[model samples]
Target: MVNIVENIRKQIDDAVRNSVSKAVEAGELPEFEIEEVTVEIPKEKSHGDFSTNIAMQTARMAKKAPRQIAEIIVKNMDLEGTYIEKVEIAGPGFINFYLNNNWLYDSLKDIQRLREEYGRIDVGGGQKVMVEFVSANPTGPLHMGNARGGALGDCIASVLERAGYDVTREFYVNDAGNQIEKFGISLEARYLQLLKGEDAVEFPEDGYHGEDIIEHMKNYIEEHGDKLLDVDSSERRKALVEYALPKNVERIKKALEEYGVTFDVWFSEQSLYDSGEIEETLEYLKEKGYTREEDGALWFKATLFGAEKDEVIVRNNGVPTYFLADIAYHRNKFLKRNYDRVINLWGADHHGHVFRMKCGVEAFGIDPDKLDIVIFQLVRLYRNGEIARMSKRTGKSISLTDLLEEVGRDAARFFFNTKASGNHLDFDLDLAVKQSNENPVYYVQYAHARICSMLKVLESEGIKVPDVDEVNVSLLDKEEEIELLKKLAQYPEEIRLTAETLEPSRLTRYVYDVAAAFHSFYNACRVKGEEEEIMNARLILVDSTKIVIRNVLELLSINAPDKM
Candidate 1:
């Protein structure tokens, strides 16, 4: 929870403002209300530790050139008892503050003090948040899109939790919709084709064509022994659905669990209809004048919410649409369950549905802004420099199970989240399983493992990791050591940013950067054979780096192996 980086930035911001105030009081510059002072870390080391553009921002108000304003502000600055070692005016009146390495040293102590609690920040203030993702239709096995959504949604929920949110992971089961209806139809046709002849029954064109349907029917006949042969078709289909839907749902649960995703709620869509919530939602929309009955169908006025057209909530047959159930589901999340925020991760195909769903939420008097839907792009699996689609074992499209078996859960989860959700990801099957540094997951885990191995060897030689107070952290002034400390200082701010932007990929990149920094430091600094004081200091640094790497990997639900 101790964010040294943010604390330093805040201190600099206050210092800048205080200097501007002092300049005004000294009659060196005209008095103007400082709206905001922005402090940023310089990209180039020669530029300085921190940079600000306060001079340029105040130039117009002070009626002076920016460089002149910069000189006046710098002249009035009180740098005593602060981390600022010196200040310089760079190109175009940029005020760059070079700081002593005290902040990095303090960050190391903070890491040693906080340990696993290092990267946590109070950004959410414990607001209740529900993240619904990978709500794939339980009609078949999950595919690559579902895999990506699972990784992203789980990591986002973890990031939110670390950012102090009371988070709930949920999966909205589409059990009552047309998809389930088609599922039943597909199962019934498969059952009849298996029990009777394959040519006897005609499969519906819109029914599911996956082999899983046939497999389900086969298992059902093996268990039930043609007991449904004498039953009516509608009743038989209903029975088939009753037997198979839960199995498919359970399979989905198992796959996601194996991929390190567990939901706090497995919300069933049929529960809404069974509890009359869907009807209540429709009635609520109608009472609010957001709906109208036309052509014997109930249509929602989506255009009222800036949509291009109206949408039908119920068909002429009085059957509710999936959109209506979705409204009811979100209403349950907001009104019934009373979550402060509801985040949904949807696939690219649902891009157009995002706006209309927001409209539906607004129709029920809920703030549509509270409903955040992330539409992630498609995933292409590549192997041996070619697009790989089918499973080597099943000869069907790759399922989550197939992916886990091939590249493993860590590789699957890490690779799926290596890119932002909005970008297209081509999962490299070859690199994912590789043990070399070409694989990012392996590279990061190897860094952690390398540290663990080093510590283990030191422990065997009776050179244990020292406490922060036991080491003179001032000795960590090497470039590689400072770089690693900077990366360590960034973990808390990174989590805050990830929570704010709802992008877990930021943490993925941050962890990789940490690994790279640690590798560079290890290559340059010798931790064990140095003098007692310096060795203890570098040992503390190495241990802190190990803790951060393990924390990040654990947050991502990836394994941090102790040995490579």
Candidate 2:
């Protein structure tokens, strides 16, 4: 809960307010109500550690040039008790605060005190949220898109939990409606062809053509010996689906669990229809005048909610559309279960569906803002400078299982999370498995391993990492040492930023930058041959870096191997 960056920002804000008040009391500037003060890290270090544009913001009220106002505020500024070493007025109207090394020392101490909890914050206020992702159809194996979604959704949930949210990860199983109907048809064709030859059966043009269907039928026949061949076509298809659907769903679960993702809920779409939720939701929509009858179908007035066209909720044959079922499912999340917020991770093709779903929620008298849908683009896996689509092991299209088999789980997660959700990713097969610094995950893990190795050698000679109070932290004044400490101090702020943006890629980039800083420090400074006091101080610093790196890796569901 201790955010060092936020603390420093608060300190600077109080100092700025007190300074302005003193200036007004001393008659050095006109009296006016001050709005909320803004503080941010300066993009360029030459400006200062932190900068504010309060003077520019107050220019009109003060009736003076911004530089004049800034100078007046600075002259009356009191730097006592604040961590700021000095306050300077920069170009036009900005106030830049230079901090002493004390903030860096406190950051190091906090890390040692909090250990695994160093980067956790309370920005979410413990709001309950449900994150549903990688809800691939149960008719087939999960592919590359599901792989990426699983990584992003899991990481996003972890970040939210760290930010003090009551988070639940969910996977919606599409085991009903049109997809299942097509699945049954596909299995029937495959089964009839296996029994009566391919020429006797006509496969539906829209049925699933993947070899998995054929395998399912083969396995079924091997067990039953054509017992269902004399049965009705509908009954035969029903038997095939009953035998295969559960197996496919189980395979999906096994693959995801192996990839280090386990959901809190495995929701079934069929449950909505079975529980009469779909009918209840449509009746509610009809009561609200958002629906109409046209062409023997029930239509929704989507244009009233910013959509360019209307949508059909139910077909003429009395079967509800998938969109209607989706509305019912969300209703269960909000109205039945009472979650404070709900987030859905969808593919890029569902971009248009976002607004319409939100509209559906509003039509039912619920606030649409409670729902958020994030759309992620596709990923292209590259091998030896060409697109790789087939799996050598499965002899079919590459799946999440195939990806995990080729590259380890850690590489798959880290590489998939290196970019934001909206951006397309080009995953390179060669770089992911490389053990060298060319690989970012390996580079970060190597930093942790390097520290572990250093600490091991030191402990062998009876030189253990000392406590913060035992080490003289002021002795760490080298350029690289200060840079590394500064980087260490940024962990809490980075966590806050990543949570605010709902982007785990930001956190991934933060750890990579920290590793880079540590490498630079290790090359420029000598921890082993330094003086006794400096060695102890550097040891504490090195161990702190190791802890932060491992913390982030654990958050990402990646391993921090000490030996590697």
Candidate 3:
């Protein structure tokens, strides 16, 4: 849980604060309250390791030119017991601080001490978080949208766990809804069509047309025979639904498990109605005056909570709407389960639903702000420079299973996570399966494999990796060596920031950077033939990189192979 970079940043800020306080106390500058002093890492290395614009911030209150204030601050600065080697005023009032390599050495020590736990941080303060994703209808096969959402949601949960939140991965099963009704109708139609002629029963125009529906009925006929044919359509459809729903749910679970995702809760939508939570939620909303009747339908006053218009919670037919069930589901999440925060990963098609859902949660006497909905744009599959709409195996829409079969689970997860959720993703089939460095996942895994090979060779040569303290880390003065250490130092801070932003894609980008740094270091600095102390330090550095790279891959649920 040690963040050496943040520790150094705090020390730098403290030093600057002390310098400002001393100048004010000595009456060399007018007294003024400092609200916040920001210490930032400079993008350009030569500008210094850390930089602050404290003087510029104080210019108005000090009634002096920024450069003059900077001079006074620098003259009063005390650098004792700080990692700062020197401080300089650059470009009008920016105070640039150059540090001794001690902080870098300290980062190495932290990594060795914490090992796999190095990147962990406690920024979340043990808040309960539930991430619900990929609650695709249990009708047919899960499509590419579910695949992307699964990877993003699962990785986000992992990041939150590392950042110190009690995280739950949930999949809301739409087992009871209009979709299920349609599923039953579709299965009945397919079943009857198999026993009778295809033209004997008319398939509903809106019924599911996927081959899975046909297969489900075909299997049902084999197991149960044609007894269902004598029953009324309603009784037969109900029986067909009872038989097929479990299989569909099981298939969904198996597909997700194969894709490296497992849910803490497979929350069923029917549970809300069965447990009376939906009825209770409606009554609660009515008590809050958020519900009213219009056009013979029970309407929620969505406009009261910033929605563009009111929405129907219950139709005139007296059955609850999906919107109503969804509100109750969120109510169950907040009031019954009592999660401190709930995040939903949805497709961009749910854009309008987001506003009403937030309003619904707010009406449930909970803070709607705690409900975060990230609408990720859909993923389009491309193979050989053409859009791939049909799966070769399923002969229908490309499913999560099909994607896993073609690109591999590791590549699919890695590629899906390469972009932020807010952006559209074009998943390139050719690039994902590439074995060379052109593939990002292969490049990253190869870095790990390369290190494993190096470590093995060194071990066989009787050159073991020494402890961090046993080597003189100052021997790591080469540019590549320092760059690699600097990147290692960033992991902890990166974890914290990614958690704050709720963006798991940052972790992917970070590991890729670490891989690049390691590759650059491998090419420039020879770890084997160096003098004893330098070789030992580089060996420890390389080993530390392997740990971090593997840790990140594990978090993303992608395998880190010892050999690629």
Candidate 4:
């Protein structure tokens, strides 16, 4: 369906064309531009529906007062087949139109006709886009910080799919990093402690200290037997360390899925190693003169591409750094998969690393514009005014699994969507559990379920959902009823605007507003058996509200249960 804004613009265009033709025919001013007309929502809803600066823009050219131009434009205006209730020049010649309720009733009819597919458009036109997110190293179960990325990435993928993009969700496993090695050693110490019944653990102070490591150790002992514990060589040790990667990744994957975060691809860091892509990337960078020898290791002169200083790509031991593998990984995403675009969802701490990746992307011959990096600021979780900062390595960061256990997937998604990505979020568990007041997620969900309850009650009485378009929408003229239709009519514009800004928080706020509008309409009117035409129209409006609320909640990856 055409968006209401565009539809209104067409009406304005027709009016302007007639007005301009009259002026040209009368020779008021030799040829004037009629291109500056605009129709945008007014701040004060009571003033008018949408205000346009077209009259003011044309006043200077027409050599008339802005009011005079507005009068001429209004005189030529035709509201036939449109919803324009009134057009007024107010506050220094601003032309504002008040829309009649019919505009909204029509949108409600379309919503009933479209159902799940309402508010949808083919804006992407079938572009292939890959989203790589929550690619946290497989050193342990997802931490609370990782949970934020998981929820965000999953939500982004959902929205893209709705926007008609061919979306692929990817999780990059950095199993070949220093962090993984530390994780394996931590498991080894736990293995020894469990085998020999030794009380003291040989794990380093900086290694993972979570109790889950003990479980991993017991499983390894059960599988590998006692001989595996006393392996003494560095080569065998690294082999055993690499052996634990799958186990760690399995734990991470389970936690994410349980939290309602799903990925289509698990792109391994070892693949970059296995395919010699890291070596090829370094050599390619060398060809670009971005590599140099520093401190007996090869470094990428990232400063040339706006880094604070050069970064080592490979150590003296000939092992490439994590960053090299990341570059190699992204290189394949564009070159091999041939994705039209790549979106990297990284934590705030990785902000400094974005420049070099962009630099490396350029050096690899792919346009840097194609690689989009979204850096989410750090998340500070709280459980009832007290901060939750339990870490696995330091025992100071909250476990992601535990967070999911405390809050269901719906609440977790709501928690993440509560704040803007750029702002630091204090995800309070207590707030998430609250049923009412300021908790936007539950608030919207409650509204959805209430309507379902009302529908079921009506259903029991043999009332079926009406074909609203078949009904006479002209009967729906009550103030609150008209208000809902207006809100319903704005869905297309809302979706486009949210996608344009890449701001899901826009929907977060919008869901509450939509719910409030529906609630107001519900309480102020009684439509059990009154005018069948208006009854069907109101039902359609309610149905569309439910559908849009669900769409918005789904975009945030929050469940829109018919029962809260």
- lDDT score at residue 211, model 1, on the 0-100 scale: 87
Clashing pairs in 2: none
State how far residue 100 of model 2 sits from its true place (Å).
Answer: 0.8
CA lDDT for candidate 3? 0.91
| Tens digit of per-residue lDDT, candidate 3, span 223-251 | 99999999998899899999999999999
Q: What is the TM-score of candidate 1?
A: 0.96
- Per-residue C-alpha lDDT of model 1 across residues 442-464, encoded as one tens digit per residue: 99999999999999999999999
- Candidate 3 at 372: error in angstroms? 1.5
Question: How many backbone clashes does every candidate have?
Answer: 0, 0, 0, 7
Model 4: per-residue Cα lDDT over 148-212, one tens digit each: 77777777777677767798999988777788778767777777778887675566788888766
- lDDT of all predictions, in order shown? 0.91, 0.91, 0.91, 0.77
Q: What's the distance in Å from true for residue 363, model 3? A: 1.8
lDDT measured at residue 190 in model 3 versus the true structure, 0 to 100: 92
lDDT preference between candidates 3 and 4, better one: 3
State the number of backbone clashes in model 1: 0
Write down the lDDT that model 1 would get. Answer: 0.91
Clashes of 4: 7
Query: lDDT of candidate 4?
Result: 0.77
